[model samples]
Target: MKGKLAAAMRNLGLCVALAGLTACASGPMDVSGTTPGPLSIASEGSFFIGGHDVHSDTLSTVPNYATSGTVTVGQVYVSYQVPTHARPLSLTLIHGCCLTGKTWETTPDGRMGWDEYFVRHGFPTYVIDQADRGRSATDIETINAVKEGKAPVTALPALFAASHEAAWAIFRFGPQYPQRFPGEQFPLDSQSGLWQQMVPDWIASLPTPNPTVPALSQLAAKLRNTVLISHSQAGIYPFQAAALSPNGIAAIVALEPAECPSATGDLTPYTKIPILVLFGDYIDQSPRWAPRLNACRAFADAAVRAGGHVQLVLLPDVGIHGNTHMMMQDRNSLDVANWVLHWIDTHVTAAAS
Candidate 1:
């Protein structure tokens, strides 16, 4: 007993087994004969450059404020993690609208999220809060301009938040909270906590060359061959970023994307990079998601025709059901994550072969 306690202290890690017994250093060890990492953050910082250099003479009669040229537009925050024995591949998780990198952290149900899960499974992980969302800073001036009708915006409409009912329907959570589909995998008991995560929506900055594209592209360029896992409103970001810098992305896993690139657009950038589009159950029931699915299918078809490798996975077809758009927070979220891990492994193997 003394020796076991000593070892536990040495490893300084604990795992709860199925038998409900606490074990220390009882699992697979790394090449160094140590337990796998516990998702330590390797680095974290914001990618920002919305400020003009303040240029003014040291001695100016005019007020320094007037002479100074300083204005900050925005910044995107990124958090990175690496396992003790990480695989060669890396993953970047991009959250959807009304969410942040927190979406990949602990779920409302108190389960470890994909960020930690992937790291434990040997993949370096990067979680991003896109510019103007979450931890990333936003430009109040730009937003106020749109709100005050001072900006000539061509594409995006005014941003707004959804009521609980509206969000329920939008998320395809059975038209109402606590009234989920039969055999629903979501933890309905935790609905209150989950609902608390809902944040006000940011303006859709699609037209006028959205700044997010360039910021995301810059992030991709900074990382070495990354696999993007984007969800919902963030689905098309990977495509755009990859198109901007084809060499950066190794692959993409888009979950219930709100949009996809046009089938008519050039897909040359995606030819070498593989893509997997995953859809959950209850999609057919949502009037909103039907067209999105069709668009994604068309995009996949176009990608395939362009000599790109793309696969679409439907949860129900694989015997997994009762999933909603927020599958990451569902009771079967671990199962879904396992499937994604398997897909990533397969891709890695294919690349090696």
Candidate 2:
């Protein structure tokens, strides 16, 4: 009877585990209600690359470029427009957690957008859908390996995706840390523990590669003269990957990325590269946004201290409507995009001279 009871308990546990897995597998909702408007490029004239016009108005003609077979988990979908006449400047934009590559484009309202901005400027823009989010395979076993003390198979990518600042805080602070919650001294560590427990199975389910070094080396080879543009939680991957590269990246544009744990090691490798950070002050109005902004500030400070060329743009008080985290979809996003393009142009010129 005892053996039978044990067997029943095991089955029950398995059922619960499967249910939890199913929950985590669910992706984010499509918040984009209306298609964005036509992209407007500020280039001197029309240019062509890979048979596509860099400043085309027709969105349907935009080529869907795939960067696959290089990474193990997902087929990276890149929407590209290469300028035929100009030297190709690659801008890879990485989305935040739960959000897809579509988040970088126009919203359902059709008022705000990004596609036209890059294409118009003669820059080839590529937006990435991180593994397990969009068309990427989710390896539950791999995640489990990390929680079990086994080194994860994919180093930089996994670290960026799975490692949250809140989790690291819990590991450092313990239970009483929450007594200071939401204010200065508030227990960020406690929140991290809560997030970990909330998604423990998902954390434990990630894969660990038998040989991480070679995997990273292969990833580096896949990326050439690329400028990494990351948003929110997704910042971890670009930062980590750029650090691993010998020449590093051309530049990085981080839009309100989550904070990095102190344990994550030095980010000084990217010191020579330009790092542009765009933060939304109004994000703090929502309870969900406060922690993320705090984390972003912390990470920005660290990157600057490490000698990275850091530029922090704090959004002004534009009233209740301004706090949205999806600033890329805002009409004013053009200002930010122009700034980024100018920076890239300057960098490219400097490299040539």
Candidate 3:
């Protein structure tokens, strides 16, 4: 029976063995073995890469702010340039799954990349290294705890593990359902797969910081303007975070972001903030692309209905191919950055007026 069950899952395009199931599985894969030093504050300047002044900054101190009773689960790697100008905005850049924050740098072609473009335009930009990715610490002890049953299987890490398992099950069981194993309806069967159902519960199980209230408080305290730029899968973080604190964020730029499944809740909270969504025409390559794009459309419509600003820009002649989700690496990435900067400038001006 067990063998038959396993065989059934195999036909479903699901992997029985969970990939990256280590204690370090929650974030991006860090195979570089380089440990970054403590964060610090620094000045704005240009770093030479390929014979050009690509705006860059050294690691500075982490911003000192009151924790919103949530343990900081991840170490955010901030590469920012504090530009000297009036009403300068600070941007937090979030990367997609399996990628590090370095993906935001300019390409070899000398076009201004996301980070460089923002910095050169006088916007301070910070990239977060989500927990278990890049230089961030992995919660190995937590994994061991859950596996040993010392912790609830429903704990955040455990939930995440289960979610991955569910994905694997679907992938493995999906293909066999109609052939090798017929008429067996696995509870995890769906095009969205099992991960969609599990992510929200996983996110809820994890420690959530009241980034909205505290981020707003921090902005108020510093009297600085702020915006969030999220790419690919990481897009969900800021969108949900902003939804949690809509009034705190000035604007949001979602670059080929993965959409939050509706089961998460009404994301209506974010509809009140200005949002500029940049989607690649090639988004359909991934299995999740259509669902994600649909989710983005719904969110965009909601934002517009709330009397908030929203713009959807589709990349011309682009499609799901190599590096489709990595807009920062695309040849036309600089063009997208330029448009984003202009959008920000225009919106800020409109807000002020």
Which sections of candidate 3 miss by over 4 Å? 1-75, 106-112, 143-223, 260-268, 284-286, 317-323, 350-353
* Cα-based lDDT for every prediction: 0.71, 0.47, 0.49
User: Deviation in angstroms for 266 in model 3?
Assistant: 4.5
- For candidate 2, what is the lDDT? 0.47
Candidate 1 TM-score to native: 0.79
lDDT score of model 3?
Answer: 0.49
TM-score of each: 0.79, 0.53, 0.56
lDDT by residue for model 1 (1-353), tens: 54455344333344434343354564333322124333434444444522223332221223443422454444567788775545678888988878778888877878778787777665778888776676665544444444546555652345767677877777777856536677767777787766787776664643344556666777766776688899998899888888888766778999999998888888887677889999999777778998899899998998898888988888898888888888888878867887887888787442232
RMSD of 3: 19.5
**Model 2: ten consecutive residues of lowest lDDT:** 47-56
Give per-residue CA lDDT, model 3, range 68-116, as digits (tens).
Answer: 2233333333445663331355776766554456657634333345675
What CA root-mean-square deviation does each model show from the true structure?
6.5, 20.9, 19.5
